[model samples]
Structures are given as structure tokens and as C-alpha cells.
Target chain A: MHISEGVLSGPVLVSGMILAAAGTTVGLKRLDYDKVPRAGILSAAFFVASLIHVPVGPSSVHLILNGIVGLLLGWGAFPALLVALILQALFFQFGGLTTLGVNTVIMAAPAIICYSLFGRAVHGATRKAFAAAFACGFLAVFFSALLAALSLIGTEEKFFKVSVLLLTAHLPVMIIEGIVTAFCVAFLKKVQPGMFARPGMTDPVRGEKGGGK
Target chain B: MTIMTRRMNRPKFRVARMRRVGPVGFVLLLSASLVLISGVPAALAHRVNVFAWVQGKRVHVQAAFSGGKKVRNGTVRVYDSKGALVTEGTTNVKGEFSFGLRHKEPLRVVVLAGAGHRGEWTLSREELSEEPETPASHSPGGASTDTSPVPGKSSPEAVLSREELRLAVEKALDRKLKPFYTLLADSLNRRPSVPEILGGIGYIIGLVGLATYLRYRKEGKEARPE
Candidate 1:
């Protein structure tokens, strides 16, 4: 998921960076200072969740909980994910420092979309928050993978092949991430029902906080 | 009768013939000689060998070239145990690169450079028997010889000398497998632990707990409406 330096072409990289910056700006517009600490906590959770490596075939893959992030943070997920990626590049070297902007956009864009579309649907209607979380988690990862696949399409003759490889490569990891997020959301619901039931737990829905269905 | 005899004596006529050869004949001869000469190893005579060690998280690699044209753009990759790419860097203007590794694990360090580079030594923590005696000594008497090789030491397969590590890495890149090498290097650099994962999970839980407590506390205060 960490797009190394020199993977994407220059024009694509630059364009992605521009879009990411715009998205982050839009996401940050309505954030209140009081919500800073909670946002920071969510970002940190997303960051560390990627560290747990599970063995697959001859290699190992880690969890990327971009879906959970979107479900919890809503619009604020974009900025939070962007910050987390930058921090990961700088401190952990998970990805290259030079390609930080591009990587941020690739990972965060789908998360924002998922939060906007699925966050409310899963949270407002479904009493089964875990199931909603599961769907969001799976779809967000799938979308992020799709966006990456689309980025390479038509540019390289091997795009289709690489896309298949990448999608298949992430399937197992995505399933694991879905399960983890479902359980995490269930735990959140039990311990702090307000965190989800009250809209104020997140930036976009801070006024109403969480609205239990 | 004399004039008739002179008119009958005509000069003998001669015809000249020209022959042309096709280009294929010339090209075949040239290509054959090239194919014959290609089998000789003399064309690749010069290479370098590199030996590297991580001393107190600092990489110290020694390079010795076996007499050849100078190679450029050498690279080094350091990996941790889990096959993640930790660090990738290029050599300096001096054809030497030293990296201060941030990871502490049994690392696999790959030094890649161009052709003519070959490595001959692997220096793990246990391999340091005694320092090879060198004539270039600063002290007149015997100086304290540091003999312990660094724990995480790996040399590239082809490098015969320490200097050729850069070329090997570059060659690996041209082969389209530098990412795998980078992963190997990262695993050599950082020794990631299960505790780290546990701690990460622990931290997330701790934060959620704190946030939930604070949210309830804030809600209670807001209900009173001072």
C-alpha cells in the first residue's frame, strides 16, 4: 500500500498531490479546535494498525484500517490520514519521504469517500454497527486498491496484469482488516456508545454527535 | 587491290564483364568473429569487493577495487528481519557511502554496483577473529586492535571487493528486483517485535478509553448550562 518513490509517473504523482492537498483543505474546513485531541487519537490508531504483520504465502502483509478511519472520523478522515501517512514516512520509513504527497492521496482519498457514503448509512440505520463497519472496511480498502489500479491503467501496457496482482495481493489483508475493524467498532459501541451514537465525536457530525438508530 | 586489303584489316573488338557481391556475405563474416570473441572472460577483467559492518547503528563498509574503469551510481539497501525495505541510498561523490542504520536487528545488507565488482567476506558478530595486520599504523607501538565485527553484516553476491557493493545493487535494480532486495535490507535493519504490535494495539485502546471518559465528563458539564 505504501507506493515507493519513482513508482508513479511524474505527472500522475504531481496531480495526485494537488488533489490530495485540495481534499485535505476541504476536510479541514469545519474542524473545531476542541476536537483536535480526538482526531489525533484516531490518526494514531490508523497509523499503528498498519504495523501488525500477518503471514501470507511466502510473505507477510499488515492491516490498513482506512475504512475504520472513515467510519469513525467522517470528513476529518482525509486530513487525519494525510497527517498519519506523512508521519509514517518520516519516522517509520514505511514509504519514501519524497513520495509522501502521492501516497497520502492514494490512501486517504477512498477513505474520505467511504466515510461520506458509508459512514452515515452504516452508523445511522444499522443496529449491527459491526456489520456496517465490516462492509465499510472491506469497501474502503477495495476502493483504495481500485483507485491505485485505475491510476496505472492505459499508461503501462502491463497495467491490467499489475492490477490483478495487486487486487489479489490485498484480498487476504483486506479481509483481516475488515474483521479487526468490526471488532474494534463493536468494542467502541459497548464502551462508549456516545462515541458512535453522538455526532459530536467526529468533526462533520459534531453537532448531533452520534444518532443511534 | 592495296586499299581493299587495308580496309579489310579491322581492329579486334574486346568485351569487359563486371561482377557484384551482396552485403550478406560481408556481414556474416563480421558477426562470426564477434561471436567467437564474446566467449572470452577477458572482456570483464576488473571488479571491486566490499565488506560492511554495522557498528553502534552506523554502517562502515570497506571498498577495494581490483583495477578497472571507475563505476558510478552504486547503491546500498538495508533490510530488517521481516522483509521490509528500511533504507536505500546511493554512494557519495567519492564512490563511498556510509549509512547510520536506525534499526537494530540481524540485517542483510546488500551492496550493489556495476560490473567488475565482487565481494569476498561476510562479517557477522562472531566472525571477527583478529584484525588483518596493516602496515599503515598511526602508533609506533602496538595499538588496541578492535576485533569484534558488527552483528548485522551482509555482502552482495558478485562483489569481490568492498567498493563493488554499489555496482551490485545497481545491477540488481536493472534486473527489476530491487524492491525485493530493499525488503531484505529493511529486514536486516529493524528487528520488529510482537511487543511493538501489542503496544500499538494497547495504545489505541488506551486512547479510546480516555476519550470516552472525557466525552462523558464534558457532556455532564454541558447539561448543567452554567
Candidate 2:
């Protein structure tokens, strides 16, 4: 969900940019050199995913996949999502450049939070991992929607109704993302189990401490 | 082959089989579900877009989503260059709204389609001007020598006063420019094509690659001994 330009006030935009800059700094620091390719791939996934519109009730919403990105890349989701948002702004004007910072924070903050919440649990056994991944996906969207609504509320008091509608509209997206993230997690577990390992650790070959906490 | 080969081959085969049956099949299934879900006729992604232009002494606006669905019953607000509210109203069923031009300065039109979706377009002073710099007298019908209406043979234009004739000319110019206005709206409302989507993805990859390269170089230097 992208917030278009001119909807936010000057103070909100400035503060958003400041917070986003700080997040990017920490995200880049946590982004190891070996993880760059993974981050890049996820960034591309995010870029493509947002274009695939899934029609819900009155309005349609697209895949964000930020939850998957967070589960896999941890703090790296910030820079990865920022890249995707920049491209969306430049090419499709999905969100304007002036509001890019706010949009980035709106989407990426929840992603980082998801990473902190379920990043480790996603490496557990099948059932546990699936549950955690589902929560990761579901809560990521829910929190991002909440943050988006909060940003709009900061801009104008009249946006209260619009904010509520936005949250309600995204409920289906939360469910869809939860299922998708679960499937993706299960797939990754089989193909490249090392992805779920904690950062700074060597790849866990089969039978070694494969299941992270 | 020994037992080692059999043991290794078993997991490899299972993994390969799982790959085909898992991620790939899941992707296909997801695509199929998306296709089926999107089959509903009312499926539309709502990205509000507003386009406005000056017509006569009024500013007309059209607001719609990306898929060309009208944003019915939305609020349309016009703000002057000073950031003051000029006028505000609701869009009609056709997602169209109009208001008399109250200020000489530039105006910004914002359409609120509810659900946190908003679109905006601005009308610059030059674009809003109804008359060109050249005097109307220099035009073909500028000189109105007839002071009296010819009875029983009067055309509507011939009976009008100078001001009414100018108003009529303005109306005619607006009619002539109707196509251009439509063209403007069409261009503004056009959705991103496939190439644009690919290009956007390419840009994301390029930026990520740059970041990766920089990080790699820095890490390489750090890993090396002086």
C-alpha cells in the first residue's frame, strides 16, 4: 500500500525521511556481504510482486511479500524494500518521490518488526515454522496497514475514516500473504534450508542443527 | 556404485522431486488461483488518478482508479496557489467535478477516493487562461460592424452584443479544444505498460547490484591483510 504525494504534511515527510535514513543505515550494517544476493533477489521479488494485483472486495490489492523478505533477510528488508519503492515511484508513480520516505517506512518498519518477532522461529520444524511464517506474513501486513493509517492520521484528522477503510480492506491481503508465506517457507526449508539459519553462521548441511529455535 | 552412492542419490532424488512438486507446483497453483480469483468482473486495483483542465470559466476534473473505474462520490477539493481552499465539492457518479474558477492564480485539485487513496492535478495559470495574448479584434470575427439586428433574417451570432460574441467565441474555442482535453486525460490516466514494469524491475536490480558491489569491495578490503 503506497501513500501518494501531497497527502502528507511537511513535518511528517521530513520526519519520515529522517527515520528512514536511520533505518537504512542499520539495515545496511546488518546486511552482510554474503547476503547481498539474497537481498537483491528479495528486492526484485518485491518489485514484481506489487504489480500482481489480487482483486478483493471493492478494491484490489497487490502482493507485498515483505513478510517473506523479513523472514529471510531480517533487517535487510529495509534497503530491499526501499529499492523497490524507488523503482515503483520512478516508473509507475505508484507513490510519489516526495512521499517515498513515508511509504518506505510504512512498509519496511513492519517487515523489520516481523523479522525480530519470527525470524528465528521460521527455522523450526514444519508445523511450527509454517505457523510462524504465517504469523510473519499476516502481522507484517497488519502492522504496515496500521502504520499507513497512522501516517495518514498524522496528516489530517479527516483521514480517520479513510484509515479505517484501508485497514479493513487489507484484511484479505493479510490472509493471502499468510498462506503464501507459509508455502514459501516450506519450500525454502526443503530446497535451501540454510536460508533460515541465523545470520553469521555457516550453512547447515542436512542432519546438523538444522532446526533453529 | 557402493552404498554411499545409493544413499546420496536417494536424498538428491528426493530433493529434485520435491523441488518440482513443491515450489514450482506451488507457484503454478498460486497462479491458477490468482487467475480464478481475478475472473470476477469487478476486479480492479484502486489507485486514484485525477486529471483536470480549464473549460471556459470553470475547472473540470475527472477522477478514477488505475483500471479506469470511476471513483464515484469522492470529495474534490481545489486549493489556490496560496494554499488556501478555493472550493470543495463531491464528484458525480461519472467521477467528474467542476467548479467556477474563483482565483487568478494557479490551482491544485485533489480527489479523495476514500480508503486512503488520493489523486491530485494542478492547473497552472498559463494553462487556465481562456484568451491568448493577441487581441480578439485581430481574429476573423473580431470586427463587428453591424450595430443592429437584421429583422426576419437574424442569425444568433449576428444578434449578440460584443461581449456576448466574445463569450460565444470562447465557448466555440472550448468546443474545438475538446479533443485535446480528452487526449490530456487519456495520457494522464494511461497505465504502466509491460516494458515499464520490466524497466522498473531492472532499475531495482541495478541499484541492488550497485549496493552489493560496494559492500563486496568494502568487505574484501577488510578481509585482506595490509
Candidate 3:
């Protein structure tokens, strides 16, 4: 979810921009030539995913497939998500340019965190991989919501007490994200297993470069 | 579950899972998402917008999201140019609220759709008096407060034909142009069109190609180490 412009305080917005700039720089440096296409594709996916409203729920929140982005792209999630967020701000007005940095961090930070937590586990057994995928999807949105609520804390609106209220609004989105991520992981495991390599672009399945999980 | 049998195994199982929600499922989901994202997209979270203006005797406000969804039950706050709260109310089911045209200076209307989403609109003092002002005096209170036709009819000496004609025309115009306000808000915050989305995708693709080419050059045009 995007925190619209003018909602955050001045210092919060500035800090968010600094963090976003730093993250993007690191992401670009780590982005290898071969991974460029993958990053672009995932960027497009992140752009389109936020528009896909979960049809199963009455609450109406869209998918933020940041878990898949991080699963595939490591630190590169920052740059990928930043690009998508810019387009969304410009075209969809989902978030404005002033709030782009905060929104980018809101989406990408959870991705990196989820990737760190469960990156390797996806290569395990089918059931375990799916479980990890569900966690990845669910928690990515969870962290996004928490971060959003935290950002709102800068406005001095009883941050702790109100954060739970915000979390309940995101409950439906979290479940749907979990399901979609599990499904996508299952699908990708069959069609393109090579996409889920570890850092430095090494393959874990064949153990050719990554030297086994 | 399709995911359980989705692992590499008997070709029969792979086929069956594929027949269900495997890669085929991805394709189905992608198509459905494309359809939903095409036009008339729904569910815009945290994108609130407010549009308010002086309409007849009241200042009307409308709040909506980028996806054409109303910001239902949102709190509406009115403030003068100095940012002091003048009045407050809650929007109805249609995301609309109204307040008396009491202020002479510019007024700011802020709508809080909750969850850190906020939007504001401003109305000028001149627009509030464009309807009909009490003749023979320039007091903004006299003009903004006593806009009722009942009082205008009761006060025989204070009535003017031009003022009556203006009020009549404004009331008729307000009714006729009511739908246009929604249109104005829609156009102001319309969602990305298909071409705009395609263009964004194109930019990503182009950036990908550029990054690949630049990195390829840096690596001395090797075979990508595949």
C-alpha cells in the first residue's frame, strides 16, 4: 500500500528519500548484466501486481508481490521496486512524486527482509517451499503495513494504538498475497527453476556454481 | 493441492497439476489481472482526493480515490486561510459533505480517509459571493448569511431583479452541473491508461536493455559466462 504524499512529516519524507537513494545505489551496483532482464520483468510484475485486486475479498486491497521480487532479486529489489513506484506515481497517481521514496521503502524493505529470512528455504521440499512462499508473501505485506503505520507515527497520532487498526485493514491483502506467492513459486519451480538462484547469480539446484544448498 | 504434486515426478502428475493451477494457473491469473487492470480498475488504497467549491448557499465537498471509489465516511475538516479549523463534519455514503458559506476569505477543506490518507481543496472568497450579495452593504456576513430566497422576498426594499436573476440562474446551473463535479474529479485523478501502462513497461524493458548492454561492454563482450 502507498502512503500518499502530504500525509508524512517533513523529516520522515527526507529520511525515506535518503534510505531509498542508498538502497537503489546498492541495488544497481549488485545488478549484473544477465540479471537485468529478470529485474525488468519483475519490475513490470510489481507495477502490475498492485493493480490486481483480490477478487475473493470484500475489503478490496491489491497484491504487492514484493516477496517474489526479493526471492528472485536480493538487494536488487530496491531499484526494481523504485522504478515501478515511479511509474505508478506518474501514471496511476497511486503515490505522488513527493512520497515516492517512502512508498518504495515500504514495498522494498519487506522484500529484502523476507528474502533474507526464507531465500534458501524455497529450494527445499515441495511442502516446505510452499510454506516458505506463503510466509514470504504474507509477511512482505505485513511488514509493509507495519512500516506504513510506523511512518504515520511521525504525525504523532498515537502510533502504537492506531497501528493495529491499520493492520486489520491489511489482513485480507496478506492472505491473498500468500496464496498468490505460493502458486507463483510452484509454477516457477517447474517452468524456471534457475530463476531462484542465490546471490552472485549462482545456481543452487544444479550446484554448478553455487555449490549446493 | 496442485503445489504438492507440482514437483518433478511422474509426467502424469505434472500434466495433471499443469491442468490445474500450475504454469497454466499463472497464465490464467495473468489474463484475469490484465482484464481487471485494463479499465475501470477498482480498489485504490491510500489515494484519497478532495474537491470542494462554493455551490449556492453551501460549500459542497467531494472525496474520492484514484480508482473512482468514493471515500466513504471520511472526516471533513474546514479551515480558513490561516489553517485554523472553522468547522468539521463527516462525509455521507456518497463521500460528500456541505457547510454553510460562512467565511469571507479563502477556505480549505481537508478530507481524512483514515490510514494516513488525506486530501484538500480550497475555495476563494470571491467565488462565495458570486451568487448574490445583499445590496447597499458590503458586509460579507450580510451577503453569505442571508442567501435564502424567503428573506429576499420578505424584504421588499432590499430585493433587486439582477440579484434574483443571478440566484435563479445559479441554482439552475448548480443542479445541471452536479454530475460534472464527479467527472472533474475523475479526470483529475484518473488511473493509468493501457498505453501509459504499456509505456511504463516499455521504459523498464529499455532500461533493462541499456543496463545489459553497458554491463556487457564492461565485461569485454564475453559470452555472458552462461
Best by TM-score: 3
Which regions in candidate 2 have their CA more than 4 angstroms from the true location? A158-160, A197-213, B1-12, B16-47, B102-105, B131-184, B215-226
TM-score of B chain for each model?
0.30, 0.65, 0.66
Interface RMS for model 2: 3.8
**Whose lDDT is greatest here?**
3
**Clash totals for all candidate models:** 49, 0, 0
Error of 1 at B187 (Å): 7.1
What's chain A's TM-score in each predicted model?
0.84, 0.90, 0.90
C-alpha positional error of residue A174 in candidate 3 after TM-score superposition, expressed in Å: 1.2
Ranking by TM-score: 3, 2, 1
Which candidate would rank higher by TM-score, 2 or 3? 3
**What DockQ values do the models have?**
0.02, 0.45, 0.45
**Candidate 3 lDDT by residue in tens digits, B1-226:** 7776665457877655654454345546654644654354465655677888767768889987656577778889998889899999999888889888764778888888776677888887777766445434544345455556555454533445545665678789999888887678667666557898888889898988888788768777576674
lDDT of 3 by residue, A1-213 (tens): 687777888988999999999999988887766677778888988887777664322224677889888988888899999999998888777778988889889999999999888888887898999999999989999999888888888773787765776677778778877877887787777655656756544433344325322
Task: Please provide, for model 2 over B1-226, each residue's C-alpha lDDT reduced to its tens digit, 9 standing for 90 to 100.
Answer: 6998999899889987765464355445445645554454433343687899888777889987776667778889888888899899999888889987755689999998764578888888888664433344443354334433445554545435555767778889899998898677766666667898789767766766887788779888999975
